[model samples]
Structures are given as C-alpha cells and as structure tokens.
Target: MSSGRIQQALLAWYGDNARDLPWRRSRDPYRVWLSEVMLQQTRVETVLPYYERWLERLPTVAALAAADEETVLRLWQGLGYYRRARNLHRAARAIVEERGGRWPASAAEWRQLPGVGRYTAGAIASITRGEPAAVVDGNVKRVLARLFLIDEPVDDAATLRRLWLLAESLVPAAAPGDFNQALMELGARICRPRRPRCDLCPLRPDCRGRRAGVAESLPRRRRRRPIPHRQEVAALVVRGGRYLLGRRPPGLLGGLWEFPGGPVAEGESPPQALARALVERLGIEVDVGPRLAAVDHAYSHLKVTVALYRCRLTGGELRPAYHTAARWLRRRQLGDLPLPRVTRKLARHLAA
Candidate 1:
C-alpha cells in the first residue's frame, strides 16, 4: 500500500515480465529517445518493424539530421502522424547543429526539443539518464486511475495534474526508469482499458478501483464529439505507364507525395470534384474516368473516404499551384518515395 512497496512490486514484476524489445536492450540515449518518439500514439506491435527499420537506416542523431526530409518521411511512410517524423528530424538537427550532438539529460531539457512533450521527455530522461521523472501517458493514467480509484475524468486538466503528482511521488530514487516503465507495462499488459486481468496485475492488492468493483470504469474520458467526415477524390493520371504524384506543401500531411485531388463539395460528383481539383491545383484539364478504388481513412480530427479515379490529362501544361512539386513517376520509382496511406492504397489498387 505504501509508495515503497508499490515501487518494489512493480520493478520486480517488470524485471521478470518485460518484453524483450530492441530498444530495451541498451541505455543509449539516442536509441531510447528514438524508440520513445516512434512509440507515441502507436502500439508496440506496429512500432517494432518501424523501429528496427529506422535504426537500420538512421542509427544516430547525426545520421537523422543529415538525412533529407524525403528520406525521413519515406522511412516513416505508413506510420501516420507524419508530424512526429518531421519533428523527430527537426529535433535531431537541433541536437546535432545547436546542442553539439549532446542528448538532453533531464525531462525539462528534453522538453525544449520539438515534439518531446512531458510524457515523452520523462520516458527518455528516466530510462536513459536515470532521472526521477514521472511519465503520464494513456497507459500510466489508466494504471494510476484504477490504482487510486480516481472518479474524475482523467482527461480533465485538474485530474491530469493530480495523476502526474501521484506518479511523481511513486517514482523511486533508484531505478526510477524501471519503476515508470513497470507502471506503463502493467497498464499495457495487465491493467488494461478493457477486460483488465487484475489477477495478473502487480498492483492488484493495492488497486482501490479493483476493490471498489469499478476498475473497468475508472480513468473516464470526456465524451468526444463526432469527428467530421469528408469525401475526397484523387486522380490516377498515368502517362506511358508512369503515374503522376504531387508533393504536399509543408503543412498537414506535409512533405509527402500523393495523387493530386481535393475534397468533394456538397453536391459535386466524384468525377466533377476530381476534374475541378486538377484544374485548380495543377492547372491541367483532365477527363475523369471510372472509379478505381475507395479507401476509408481516419485521422485524429477527421475521417475521409477517398475515391480514386482513373483520369486522362486533356489540355494545358502541368503547372502545380498547391503542390511544391509534381512529377510522373515510374512504377519502380514509387517504392523510393514517401506516400500517404490513402495514396498507397490507390497505388496498390493500380498495381493489382
């Protein structure tokens, strides 16, 4: 029940039960930091291959800093949340060029880097530098909420602050990193959000929510409003067996390649939308053809059903207005470019 007892139980459980992940094999700050960044808003299963591939490609901060944006985005193509990849690239440059390649040793110092929030900074600092920093990610918040029988919505500003303080208090002076990771591991594997295996949990004896018969319902989140849905269209304009791709400008889904298209206005058909988008964005006239595929994709704030259509460029030269660059890429060259997931879906359809 005491903080010392909790820490002891957690660290022991972690020592025995932790997964043999590649990043866990070393205390090297770069490896630790890179793993943490890649794992943000992503599952370990999803991140595993990407993590391995990333390390193989750009193993060091200097390597990442030296890599071009296209290369960085290519490695991170399917991982989504492209902003994370961009920020990681920027942070690497900052570390190499500005910080003289020295990794930040504390959570506060790590926070100064791009995309390194409090939770990420804490994980990096504690794991690699042995700083007594608390990490309050979704997993940690869930564990803490159930352990303490917290009834307030965990997403509430006040509730979040309290949870952070509680996590800070439980961090051990020795092996604080192990303690933080243990708590997260417990939440991830045992004290899960749904159907938590409380019997297997290290904190079962001390979990107040389990005792109160409400562990499943603790760590409540505020009701999320319905995400807006948009109907999008893309044109598959191929010439001489080469497909056209456009590079997005530096913003949402930035620095990534895509089949040029735009959102469908209220009553416009997919074909009409595709034609208008091509004219406005690329300054080329196109005759929209049959629909090739329709893919549904969701982002944090929006859901889109993208309809891919085969089209032929009819009139005018290819002059891109919204995109930074436009090119007709050969089939073999597609693998080297970084494309959005929806675009990849369309590409696969074309290949099929």
Candidate 2:
C-alpha cells in the first residue's frame, strides 16, 4: 500500500471524525505539552477538568514557575500520581530560567527539558514546529501493528522498538502533526482495543489485519503478568468515635490520608504487621483485634488485599517524621479528608 494514499485517507478521516478535545484547539506548544503530561495514564474525560482548571490557574510558564508547590499540589489533588505535577512544575521553572520562558523549539531541545519523554518530544515538535517526528504511543502502536499486520507482540521490548522505527518511517513530512493525530484518533475511536468498528475505519481496506480477516486478532500482545497480590493489615485505630489517619509521604500518592498499612511480610500475619506498623510509624503500641473486614483495592500498578482491624492504642506518642500530619478525626469527618480510595473503601467496609 502507498504511504501517500494511507496518509490521505487518515487525514480525511481525522477531519471528519476526530474528537473535539479542548487541547486540540491549536498548535500551541505549552498547551500541547501540558495536555500530554496530564493525559498520561489518565482518561481524556478525567483530564479535561483538571487541564482546564490548571490552565486557568497557571496560564503561562512564568506563572507555574512562580507558583508554590503546595498550591500546585492542591490544584493537582485527586489527579493521582502527583509526581507528574511536580515534574511539570520543575520543568516550567527550568524553561523560565534557561530558555527565556518559551517552550524549547526543537525536538532535541525539548527532550532536554525535564519530564519530557521521547513520545512527548515528538508530539511537541510535530505540533508546534511541524517537524516530521512520529509519536509511537499506545494508540499509534495499536493502529500501526494492525494496519501492517506486524505479528510482534507489542509488549515485547524489541517489538516496541521496531514499532518506533516503523512509526518514524511512516510519518510523512507534510503535516506530521495532523498525520500523527489522525492515526491516534483512528485507533482511539475506530480501531479500538476490543470490539473495533473495522467497517467504519478509513484504513479498513488497507489494514492488513482486515485483509487477512484478523482485524480483531492482529497487533498481538504479550500476556501481562497478573498484578501481584499484596497483603497488608490496616489499622482502623479507633479512640472513642474517631479514627487515626496518616498523610502519605511525598512522591506517589503523596499528601493523601491513608489508614496506615504496608505489605504483610513473608510468614507474618496481618495482625502482626499492623501492630508493627503502628509502633514503627507512630510510636504507638496497639492491641490488634479481629479483622473488621478485608478489601481488594486495585491501582494502576498493583492490587492490594487489605485487612482492616479494629484496635485500641495501649501506649505511645504521635510521631510525625514519616508523615506530614497524623490526626484522629470523627468517623463522619473521615469522609471530608482526602484519603486514598483504599482508605475510603476501608471506611465503607467498616460502616457496613
């Protein structure tokens, strides 16, 4: 199949069918960069409000650079995996300091900026500078592998590297940004992960997967190892009607409240782990009780089997080195706290 013909088809398809996302409003590098960063591991619907609110709060590189971390974090609260926000803040400072507060104009120069990965650099360069750089993100990988019927499992490292080369090869010099966006849009909207609408695909006729009658089967994936189950005992330490909560340490779900818990080490029981965690973290020794309930909470990278315990503190002092703050809040007020989903799950189980 001719690359030019495929490009024409994709471009036409994009014009008619692309999602009307706010960030696609223009080729502004800063807005594009911000949207790309915010969208990582987040759904488009989820990112929309955060992006709008964030842009309204910090309209320029200088604004973000000058903003304090706490305000930044507060704005980014509930977004999850807050390191992206922090890195965005850090990179903004560097741009304002070294690059005269403008987004670096070249892909190589953009790559030099903090938090900017290869795919992000490709997006920034293509969108802003019209550079012929291809972005081999998940969407692109799915689209290309099916279009060409590439049999390499997309999850394999070598196969992914091969896909990158193929992505670059197929990226036409003319309107690289639109081309890249078109492929991504097609994959997202039409060549979906499951139950794809192949009949609606512009590349349907040219798609090798379709030609070979394997449209649903191509772009094979290496089976992902099931997320390991981690067992932990959470202290639902109740003094009167109030429960103990600790702020998660900075970096990765930072600043959120959690009923303290960690993995149940080999051969150690949940009650024992809870007892140890309380003393180690808060200088408190507690009497472990029967399990209040167990919860299965799943996050992006792992699944946790959490055992909740009703316990009383026998003796100890509140320590704050590992936590930003520790507090005993009434059960009703626990809902007001910005706790992790797992912590809220614990409360729900306890209430039931």
Candidate 3:
C-alpha cells in the first residue's frame, strides 16, 4: 500500500475523531513535552487531572525549574514513576540555565533533555515545530503491527528499530504532527488491543492483519516472567499524638516520606522484622505492637503487602541510617509531606 494513501486516511479520521485534549489545542513545546511524559505508561483519563493540576501550579518551564524538590514531589504524590517528575524538573532547569529558556528546535536536540527518549523527542518536535519526525509509542506500534500484520514481538529491539524506520518513511512532510497523532489515535480508539472496531477504522481495507483475520492479535509480545510478591512491614511509632515518618534516601521512591520499616526476612515474624528493620534502617529501637493496617500495593515490577504495626520507640539514638531525614508529625500533618500510596494507606488507617 502507498504511504500517501494510508496517511491521508488516518489524518482524515483524526481530524474528525481526535479527543479534545488540553495539550492538543496549543503548539507550545513545554505543554507538548509535559503531556508526552505524563502520558507515558498512563492512560489519558488518568493523566487529565494531574496534567491540569501541574499546569495550574507550575505553568512555565522557568517556574518548574525554580520550584523546590519537595514541592514538585508533593504535586506528583500519587502519580507513580516519580523519576519522570524529577527528570522533568531537571530538564526544565537545564533548559532555563543552559539554553537560556529556548526550547530545542529539532528532534535530535530534544533527545538531549533528561528523561526524553526517541518517542518523546519525536512527538515534541513534530507536534510543535512541524518537523517530519516519527514517534513509535505503544499506540503507534499497535497500529503499525496490525496494519502490516507484523508477527514478531514488538518489544524486541530489532522489531522496534524496524517500526521506527517504517514510521519515519510514512510520516508526511505536511502536518507531520497531525499525522503522528492520527496514527496513535487510530490505535487508541479503533485498532484497540482487544475487540477492535475494525468496521469503523479508516485503514480497515488496507489492514493486512484484518485481511488475514488476526488484527486483534497482530502485536504479539514474548511471555513475561511472573511478577514477584514481597512481604514488608512498617512501624507506626506514635508519641504525644505524633507519628514518626522518614524521608527515603535517593533511590526507588526517593524523597518521599514513609513510616519507618523494611522488608520482612524469611524466618522473621512481622513484629520481629519491624523491630530489626527499625534498628537497622533508622538506628532506633521500637517495641512492635498490634497491627494497624495491611497495605497491598503493586508497582510495575513487583507486588508488595506491607503490614503496618503500632510501635513504641523504646531506645537507641534517633539517627537516620537509611533515610535522609526523620521527623515526627501528627496524623493530620501527614498531608504536608509527599507519601507513597502504601504510606498514604497506613496514614488513612490511623486516621480512621
């Protein structure tokens, strides 16, 4: 099939059916970049509120750059994959300080920013700058896989490279941004992962997968290993109506506040593990009491069930061995600090 014909059909469909997203109304690089980052591994409905809240608080790149880390993390409290928010802050600072607040002009230059990969760079460049760059996001990949009936796993590096090349070849010089968005929109709305609405798809006639009666299963992936489950514990050490919270050191869930504790070892009971973890992680002794809450949370790579137990700080110096800082705050005051979902669940249990 000719690239021109396919592009024409997709663009026409997009013009009629594109969702009225906030970012689509403007060609501003900052807005485009922010939307692309937030939309990664997140659905549009889920990102809508967060995206609006972010702009309302930190409207400009310069504003975000000037904001403190705590404020940024606080704004991004419930949005997981906090690394994206941190990288956005870093990239904003770099753009303001190093580039004199000028946005990158081309996809190549945009790739230099922190947290920006090929897909993001291509999106921002093509959408805002009218550059003929191609984006191969999950949506685009699905569309492409079905359009050409690609049998290979989309996650493979070799397959990804081929998809990129195919995208590059098809992206039209005229309104490349609309073309890219149209292709992605097609996958999202019509060529869905399951039970696609092929009857309404503009590319229905040309879709090789549909012709071969396998459109829904064209974008196959390799079998993934089972997600490991972990058991952990947290100490709710309360004194004078105040609870102890620890600021995590730089790493996974870094800079976020949590009830002090760690993973439960294989042979250790929950209370014993909590006591040992407090001594090892916080350099303080706690008399583990009755359980307060059990938080079952799942991250991308692992699932964890954290048992929260009431504890009394018994002895030892109040030194932060693993945390950057430790503070005591009332249950109500917990709202002031950024917390992971698991920590928030524990706090809610306390409040209840």
* Of 1 and 3, the candidate ranking higher by TM-score: 3
> lDDT score of model 3?
0.92
Q: Write the per-residue lDDT of candidate 2 for residues 99-124, one digit (tens) a residue.
A: 78766878888888777889889988
Rank candidates by lDDT, best first: 3, 1, 2
Would you list the rank order by TM-score, best first? Answer: 3, 1, 2
- Worst 10-residue lDDT window, candidate 3: 343-352
Q: In candidate 3, what are the lDDT values of residues 1-352, reduced to their tens digit?
A: 9998999998989889999999999998999999999988889988999999999999999999999999999988888888888999999999999999998989999999988999999999999999999999999899999999998999999999999999999999999999999988888889999999999999988999999999998799989999999999999898898989999987789899999999988988999999998998889987888998898999888999999999988899888989989999987889999999889877788764
* Residue pairs in collision within model 1: none
CA lDDT for candidate 1: 0.91
lDDT of 2: 0.84
| Candidate closer to the true structure by TM-score (higher is better), 1 or 2 | 1
TM-score of each: 0.96, 0.87, 0.97
Worst lDDT window (10 residues) for model 2?
Answer: 334-343
| lDDT per residue (tens digit) for residues 1-352 in model 1 | 7998898889999999999989999999899988998899999999999999999999989999999999999999989889999999999999999999988868999999999999999999999988999999999999999999999999999999999999999998899888888888888999888999998988888989999999999789999999999999999998998999999988778889999999999988889999999988899999998898999988889999999999988997898899888999987888889988777777888773
Report residue 120 deviation for candidate 2 (angstroms): 1.3
Model 3, stretches more than 4 Å misplaced? none
